[model samples]
Structure formats: C-alpha cells, structure tokens
Target: MGDILAHESELLGLVKEKDLVAAFDNGDQKVFFDLWEEHISSSIRDGDSFAQKLEFYLHIHFAIYLLKYSVGRPDKEELDEKISYFKTYLETKGAALSQTTEFLPFYALPFVPNPMVHPSFKELFQDSWTPELKLKLIKFLALISKASNTPKLLTIYKENGQSNKEILQQLHQQLVEAERRSVTYLKRYNKIQADYHNLIGVTAELVDSLEATVSGKMITPEYLQSVCVRLFSNQMRQSLAHSVDFTRPGTASTMLRASLAPVKLKDVPLLPSLDYEKLKKDLILGSDRLKAFLLQALRWRLTTSHPGEQRETVLQAYISNDLLDCYSHNQRSVLQLLHSTSDVVRQYMARLINAFASLAEGRLYLAQNTKVLQMLEGRLKEEDKDIITRENVLGALQKFSLRRPLQTAMIQDGLIFWLVDVLKDPDCLSDYTLEYSVALLMNLCLRSTGKNMCAKVAGLVLKVLSDLLGHENHEIQPYVNGALYSILSVPSIREEARAMVP
Candidate 1:
C-alpha cells in the first residue's frame, strides 16, 4: 500500500506537465495513461477487478485536469459523457458536474476499493458471510456514518520540525526531570514538617505537665525527684560533652599544633581543672550539683601528680581554720559534708581525707580531730551506702592506721574487731574492699592493742587469714602475709594457727 501511494504521488507530481513528464522522458507516460483509462472504463462497467485496487490520486487528477482546461480538447466528448454519468452517480459531492437532494458514496476513481471489494473487508467475510451480507454490512456502516454526520479525519500540524509523538515524548521527559527535583525537595519538606510537629507536641505536653504540677494535682514526691534527677542528668551530660577546661600544658589540640618542633602530646585528664582558690571556694559553697562536679575536679588534681604537695596545700587551710570549726559555712564546718546526702560529696571527702592522712603531719592533724575518723568508720559500717563511697571510707581508715596514734585510736574504737569480722567474708567484697581491708588489718595488728583485739576472736581471725592465703590478687597477698605474721605474735593466735590442719 505504501509503494502504491508513493508511485501514485510521483505520477500526480509530473501530471502538471503537458505529456506527464514523470512517466515519459524521465518516466513512462503511455503506460500510466493506458492503465488509468482501462481502470476507469472497467470500474464504470461493473466495479470488477479495478474495484479491488484503490487509485485515490487518479480520481482527483481527472477532476483537476478538466476543471483547468474547460475549452476544446481531444478527450472532451468522452470526458463530457463520463462526467455526465458520474454527475448523476456522485450527486452533491461532484456538484460542478451535477447536483442532487441526497448524498452519494461513488465519488471515487476506478480500481479504488469500495468497502465490499477491499481486501480487509473480503478477509472479514471470507468464509463467514456471503456476498449479500458484505453489501448489507457496507450499507449499515454508511447509514451509521450519515446518521452521526461524521467528518473525514484531519492530520495534526507539526511544531518546530517535531511531530506530535516527538513533542509528546519531550514533554514526558521534562515531566520526569521535574519529578526528580520534586522528590528531593519533598523529602526535605517532610522532614522539616515532622520536626516542627514533634516540637509542638513536646511543648504542649510540657505545658500540660507544668500546669498540673502548679495546681498540685496528680503529682507525687517521687515524680518530682525523678524529674529533678533527669534534668540534672541531662545538664551534666551536656556540660561534659561541651567542657573546655584545657588543663596542663600540651594537653589541648591547639597547643600541640602550635609547636614548630616535633613533640608528643600528653593524654588529657579525665576531668578539667580550675585555679586552686576558685576550686576551693566553689567546693565549699557551691550547690550540690556544682559540688559534685568540683569533687571530681579535686580528685583529678590530688591524684595525678605532686599529690603530697597538693595534700599539704589543702591541709594549710584546715590547719589555720581548725579541722572541726567553721571555714565560713553558716557555722557548720566544711568537713560536715562527709555526712551530706550526696554520695559524690561523701566519696570525694573520704578520698581527700585519705590523701590528707597519707602524710605524718596530715595524719597528726586528723588525729587531733577524731570526728572525721568516726564518720569514716560509720560509713564503712553502713551496708546499704554506695559501694564506692564505702570503699573510699575503708581506704581513709587504712591511711589513718599508718600513724601510731591513729592506729591506737582505731583499735580503741574496736575497728580491728570490725575489720576481722568483715575480712572473714572476703569473698563477698570487691577487690578494692578486700585489698583495703587486709592492708588496714595488717597495719592495726602491728600494734599490741590490735593483736589483743584479734586475740578475742583468735580462732576466727586465724581461719579468715588462712582462707585469704590462697587469694589470687598478688597485691592483696603482701597485705595478707603481713597481717598473718603480725597477728600470730599473740601466743593464743599462734596456738590457734598451729592447731589448724595444713
């Protein structure tokens, strides 16, 4: 069909010339005219073989030639007769040739496929319908077309050298590109919207809670305590994360970068430090939270380096102001914090007191004031107190026992008996507790008074020390060996040791 259309268009293209130049000198003129004339005559005869083939441009060419040349012509008589017959057949469609009241479907050239004779139509009715049925279906289609007043199909115009399909494809591509950008913006928009909504919800909930709290409705002391604790924890975590103490030389990143010479940077301390006077003042007068923070700061200062010097400097204050009297605390001594509700304060005080009692002069100062020692002993006896706080108390007592005066005081306080009873169950204690207990027990037993206290429970003390002999910790082993050797000085304890099976 495409080849036929191309050939027909080529013929019509040269039909403008006098002798059909497309088919004559450049093409065959006689052959095309012969075929066209025979086709028209045969189609007029009975719509035979010519009816099966469609020559659309030939019919149009035939009408155009006669209209342009209206004067005399060689084919004028035949053309007139053929035009007269087609005028009646075509009616209004060929109105220049003829006119009528009704429509006509015969405005076609010979060899043109009318609805019935077309191959597509023939195939549809091949075995299923007779020739009579084909005519009836064609008539039905024509009647429907007339009733609906359907017009011939029109072609769409091109735009910017692009066909409709090409234009549609470009539009689709543009839409796809827009969708790509839209998705990224949409995700960001949704995230921001979710954050905004979540903030609003949290604010509303906090407002309702505060309102209820103000009215004293549905609130309990436990709830208030938990909220306070949670807020404190949040503040502490944020403070720690953003802390910028920059203690010591060569510790900060900036300090290391400033060096022109190659140098190894030191490990930063676990907590930051401030000037001694400021720290000392804050520790004594700050709120519980501030004091908790200062406690850790003080621990770092005292333990890291030059601890004896640090201990002396700290002792100078206590000595001049006196150990038990007020260092300006509403007449309450700074040392009274040993009994404070905060576990951190108690623990650091215990550790700091232990550091103070490490030296002979500091131990003597602590001995003059037995209140600190008694408080430590009380803390050690409290089973439900914080484990670390109690451990530090035990450590402070151990430090005090290094002095003869403090050792005699502890024995007179019956601490030797208490230590022996606790060490009897050493398996239940932490490594630090067991180590400190053994070391303190050894220090006390070095004296005659501590040995006498052991003699009261000689068999129990012998067995406890014997059981500890097989302990895995080598650090505790020295303390264990020393305590055993010292306590056996008592004749009763020696007899009890000997009586035990090897």
Candidate 2:
C-alpha cells in the first residue's frame, strides 16, 4: 500500500506538470492517455486522498482537448476507450466519490462543446451514485436527450416502432427517482441551491426535448400540452418569487420554444374555456402577485429570442378574451411592465405593440371593448407627452391603425385632437415631439376615415407642416413633407393645402 501510494503521488505530480498538459496540447493523445490511465488505476487501487480531484482535473483537461481538436475528427475510438477506462476507475474508487461535491465544469461543458460534432463524455459517469455526481449526470443526460439525431440506443427503439410516448414514459420514470433525489439534495445542500437551479434548467430542457421528439407520435397532444402548460406555469411561478433575470437566468424557455416549434395547434387541444370573469376576479384579488408574474413573464418573453412565442402566449392569455377583460384584468399588469426600469420589459412592450398592430381587426370581440380601446388611446396620449417613449408608442399605434382602420376612428380623432393641441403651442411644433406626432397622424390618415379626418384637421396639419418646413433640421423636413403629401392627397384637404401655400 505504501509503495502504491508513493507511485500514485508521483503520477499526480507528473499529471500536473506543465509539460504533460503541453504534450496533450501537442497532439500526444496516446502518451497523455497512457499516463492518465496509469495514474487513475493506481490511485483507485491505493485509495489516494486526492483521487477525486485528479479525476476532475483529467476530465476538464480531456474536455478541453476534445473541444480544441477532436471536433469532427473520425478517430474517437481512442477517446471512447479512455473514457471507458475512467468510468471503470470511478467505479473501482467508489469510496472517493464523496470527497468532491462540486462539478461546475460538468454542468457547463455540455453547453460549450459542439454536441453535433463531438459526443459528450457523460456516459462515463452513468453509474455515479453521489448526489453531486447524479445532478451532473442529469444535466448530461438532458443534453444528450435533446439531440434531434437519433442516438445509438434510440435507433433500436425507432426500428422496433416503439412509440415516442413509450420512450418518454420510460425516460420519465428514470428521471422521477432522480427528481426526488435532487429535491433531497437541495434540502441537504442549501448552500448549493444555485446549482440545483441548474438542475431545474436541465429538467426544463428534458421536458422540451420530450415534447419535440414525440410530436405527432403516440404521445397525445393533450399530454404534451399539459406538460407545456405545467412547465411554463412552474417557470412563471418560480421566476416571480425569485429575482430571476431571465436575460440569462439560464432557464430553458429559449430551448423549449425551439423544440415546440414543430408542434401543431391541433396537438394542443383548444384550451378548455375558463370562466374568464372568475379568472379576472381572482387576478384582481391577487393583483400584486399576478403583476409580479406578469412582469417576469414579459421580461422572459421579450428579452429572449423567442418573442414570437411569448407574444402568442400573451395574446391567448390577454387579448383573445373580451377586450374589457384584458384591460380590466391586465391593464395594471401591462402598465407595470411598461413602466418597469428593466430594458427587457420596454423592448417586450415594443414587440407586443407591433404584434398587436399586425393582428388587429374589427372583430366583434375587440370592437366591443371600449375600455381596452380607451387604455390603448391612453397609452398614445401619455406617449405624446414623454419624449422617451413617444417613438415606440407612435409606431405601435400606426401599425394598429393600419390593420384596423374602422376601429381607429376614435384613435384618429385623438390624433387630430393632439395635432390641434400641439399646433396651438408654437414651441411644441418646433420640438422633436412634433415629428413623431406628425408621422403618427399621417399613419392615422392613411386609414379608412383617416383621410376625411385629416381634412377636418387640415388647418392644424398645415400649420405644423409650414412651421416644420421652415426649420433647419433636414430630418424633420422629410417627415413633415411626407405628412403634407398624405394630407394634401385627400381632395378635401387639397383646397386647404393650396390656401396654406398661397
């Protein structure tokens, strides 16, 4: 035992020597693996105190090597053999597993490695039983499970015509025990709850992969939709309670959206009707909590790359129901998010407005909502007063007006009112606010009754444009010119334009 310990220490010393790492960097995989294998075997046999640390170090080094050179290489058999040896070493040195509780590298490396070109080495640690190791293994499995290309083991299942539901059920059962254990691990290791959050992210990824892979298969749409709703709701709840910066909270929203993209609407059976009135009542009662969740969900949806999915979800939840319900139930929530200090929320609001404009129409449901229209009108009013939010709000309104011309008469009326009010204040006409206001009015005029309304407000329009035309700002002149063209093209306003020019 003494001789074995001494030999192990010598091997550890050699492994850490800068020259050994350099040799591996120089394409000396054979030499590096030989020394690594000898040291790992000896360490396991001798029960060296630093065996786990050495194993972790080797894993890190091997990962770095694979990333730098092994990507797309055909000769991975040696790499596989080396990983197999390490797995055996770990099993042999089962007593050393408890020595190390941190596997940060394992959790992150899967994301860093090009999984498409280079397979992960996770299978090497499959038999791991420690809470820390199991957590890392779960993440590794999730990364592998998400691969669209069939895995070797899955090929047999595919050939056998085994349904995705069966595969998922099997995987779910496998993960159920792990999930329970992870909760236990969280309680036992509170200091590392953040690490458990990493597990949560992986769990989300697994759910996403299951949804993607099983689409159109025996996996019932109802089941998948239920899973998605639960997952989204869980994430929403957790994010609300915690200060999760979804910008990089490291959750799986992005991945889930990608995976679920192929999902057809039919698969997600129409959501059962909720007594929206009851739901609204409950939301109003729980306004504070609901607002928090809304803000978080908005941030997640807006800041992330999946704004379309986020936008869809919000539409279903807020817009599809009666406009009044949306306004009364979610007005405060939307306002809270819009006014939030977070740039994520602001950008999201911009996207939401744009989407709403594209989809707006004089549907019976939308037209009946006087309160919702008023709220939208109010947003435009407030935006006109504030320079910072003016452009985005105007842009949104312009889109909305174009899409729903009939419903926009009220908005057009408001625009005419604002234009008249702004022209009365000469100082306001000279300011940059006048540019956005004019452009917004131009868009309104392009709508059904907009041309007629422009004629009514012709005097105010010509006054603003005349003042803008004289200004030295070159940029303001073009926008003012465009607004003039839109207004004068209307026959009713042509006489008014000629009078102003003459």
> TM-score winner among the candidates?
1
Query: What lDDT tens digits, residue by residue, belong to model 1 across residues 1-502?
Result: 9779766755543343323323322223235456444423442323432232122223333433343334744365655554444433333323332122121123322112132354322332244332333354234334433422323232113233456677699899999999999999999999766655554444445556788978887744444333333323243535433343444333343432432355565543222112344445555776766565445434544454443444455456445545433224343556777787887777777776776666666667767766767777877887356888888788778888877877888899999888888887877899999989998999988898888899899888888888898887655776777788678778888888888867
lDDT of each: 0.57, 0.49
TM-score of each predicted structure versus truth? 0.42, 0.36
**Positional deviation of residue 242's Cα in model 1 after best superposition, in angstroms:** 62
lDDT top scorer: 1
Clashes of each: 6, 0
Model 1 residue pairs with clashes:
23-27, 23-28, 23-29, 24-27, 50-111, 53-111
